[model samples]
Target chain A: MTIKENIFENLRLELRRGCLTLAVLAQLRQEHYGYTLRKALAERGLEIDESTLYPLLRRLEAQGLLSSEWREEDKRNKRFYRLSGDGEGIFVQLLKEWRAINASIDNIL
Target chain B: MDLLDRYLQAVKKHLPWQRQDDIIAELKANLEAQLEDKEAALGHPLTAAEAEDWLKQLGHPIQVAARYQPQRSMIGPALFPFYLYVLKVAFLWATVIWTIVAVVQIAAQTPSELTVLAAVLRVPGMLMTTAAWVTLIFAIIEFVAARCPGKFPMLAPPAAHWTPGDLPPLGQQLSGGRKPRSFAHALTEVIFGFLFLVWWLLVPRHPYLLIGPGVLYWHASPFQLAPFSVLFYWWVVGVNVVQLAWRSADLIRGSWPRPRTAQTIVVSAIGLIPLGLLLSVPDHAYVLLRNPALDQARYSAALTSINLSIQWSAVILCAISVLELLWGIGRLSLDRYRKHAAAMR
Candidate 1:
């Protein structure tokens, strides 16, 4: 890639990284397994891949923001995930901050 | 082997050993489910080609495995700057230690061009080796920290606790954080040496270059440069050229050199050879200036005293070079054995 394109791609990723975490937490309020969650997020126009989603889920679980358990369904064991109580609190706080920023940007633009 | 099983096996190898079975189970379930969905979309069981395409879309085995492996590194993003800082400190110390070793090894013997040349050539390789070892050590430390950060007090501190007091004092910032430093005094030597070279080379051809009209005094008549004196003059130019190149490099870099003692001591040591050669004049050495303004007999007598004074100055210079060489050796030897000495004490 040209230097300019490389720079913008990196900045775009940085801008979206925080938003992606917030969106992931919000979706996890109701239980969803990894594949179905990815599809659900993709359906809502925020298409996260399996590699990124799986790791994010693991990290959030480790951070006590999400809890997961393996369950058998359709003759296969799948890890189901949902937001923890702490995750709900953080998601609400993040949503408020995101809306404030969005309103500020809306005013300026 | 079944393609799906083989693919899962490859991915499994790269995952953390303790967590491998569980992770693989989850991954296997995910992949098989994905494959079943693909076959359902096509309204048939998957062909080998369809399964291969599906596996390829997941990602390369290593890339997929790496994401599941705790997102850790031999050197992680949080500790990377500190690792670089450690490497920088190691590099500085190594450069200094090696340069001293080179100077002492060069000086405590008959100074030769080849020895000095070898010393200069050895530096870049030694520096690179220092850097490599420093990186390896930091990487190992990083690995340990990732596994058990509580083991080392230095690496265990939480990021939130960091304050300005925890930061080190700013060191000599230069062109490159890793290297590239120059010294002002060294730069002065380069400029002075270059100008001196211009004058030294020019003066023999045109006596008026430096002294100008002062040459007209004593009814001056030029003498032929002696064969031995030619060697001495050439040696002087060679020494000056070395100084110019060496110091100019330091100047361009904008920071002082390592083992500064080496630069001073080696320059003094190499210089003594030509001075000794010049002082060992075989016959009447004052013929360079005829001095017709004085009576012929008295002029010869005065020239004798002048040559004697030159010899005295050469002796003094020889003494200084010997002392400087000895001083450099003493420091280098002391430094080499300092750890041993402290333990003995």
Candidate 2:
């Protein structure tokens, strides 16, 4: 990509950051393993690139914003994450603000 | 072997250390189960590419890992204090300005000359108009403040809550986007800073500067009018200085992790410059000229210039103050929304 195009792409990337949190919070209501979660988000019309999402999950988990566990059965295993108490509380608030802002935008538009 | 390792690594990259280990173990078990299931379904062993394709179809590893995390709010608990401070400042300023206006109107009129009832009625009307204007301005500020990036917490309520099955892994959720600072904040500081500096410089000196020619040519007329000029200059200077200092301190405190007491002292000290200037200047000065009596025309002309200057300063200061106050209110509202959002999750 040209340098100017790369700069614009980066700028656009930054603008979309807020929505990623909202999209992630919305999908994590169920206990899905990592690969499953990505598929779910993609299905829902939000496609998060893997390179970015992997680091984010670790960071969120580290911040005490998420919980996870491994399940083993029939000689097979997969890891799963679930919303922590704090995470759940935060998710609800963000949803409200999003809705409010969305409504305001809708009205304006 | 290559496919299995690649798949495992991809999934591992997304998981936390403890979670990663757990997930790897679980996936190993689950893949074994799936292999057994495939053996039964296909009536034969599955190919390595088919297994890799199955895992790829399921989605990226990070996306699946994120699903286990709790939903996070758009707004969080971190910004509550800042919000409350803005709210209090807006309320106090609005209350004080209207209250003074109300009391002055009531005090200036004589009970015998004017009915107390009429004066009482006017106060509420004035207050209503003042409040309406304040609310209207604050609403706009609140709307603008919400769009401000990085001024609020990362998590808040209604936005955070998502179903476990639907949620992306924490890594996936955090991976995108950056927000930039708002222009309104910068504009406010610049406008206020300029007004404050100008107001500070225009303050008439205490013994008063001799206008027209000095003693060498035309008799140096040291124009000394009512002590009001000194008081007026000092008053404007004092208000501007206090406001400037207050705003500067707020900006500094907001940006830096400094002690609140130190910030307050610095702000107050900056405000005291104008007050000191007012106090040190002589209240009255002799009109050192050929004619000792005041020239009403010339005196009025001087008074007019001073009055015009003071009026312009007041207008600028008032405009900036009102805008600042509204911006403060907007900041509070945005904070409240964030807290509410965080709480909802």
Q: Please list, in the order the candidates appear, how each scores on TM-score for chain B only.
A: 0.51, 0.31
Q: Best-fitting candidate, measured by lDDT?
A: 1
Model 2 misplaced stretches (Cα beyond 4 Å): A73-75, A107-109, B3-345
Q: Locate the minimum summed-lDDT window of 10 residues in model 1 chain B.
A: B172-181
lDDT of 1 at B62: 94
Q: What value does the lDDT take at residue A58 in candidate 2? A: 55
Q: List the residue pairs that clash in candidate 1.
A: B181-B255, B182-B254, B182-B255, B182-B256, B183-B255
Off by over 4 Å in 1: B82-90, B140-345
How far in Å is the alpha carbon of B181 misplaced in model 2? 33
Model 2 docking category: incorrect
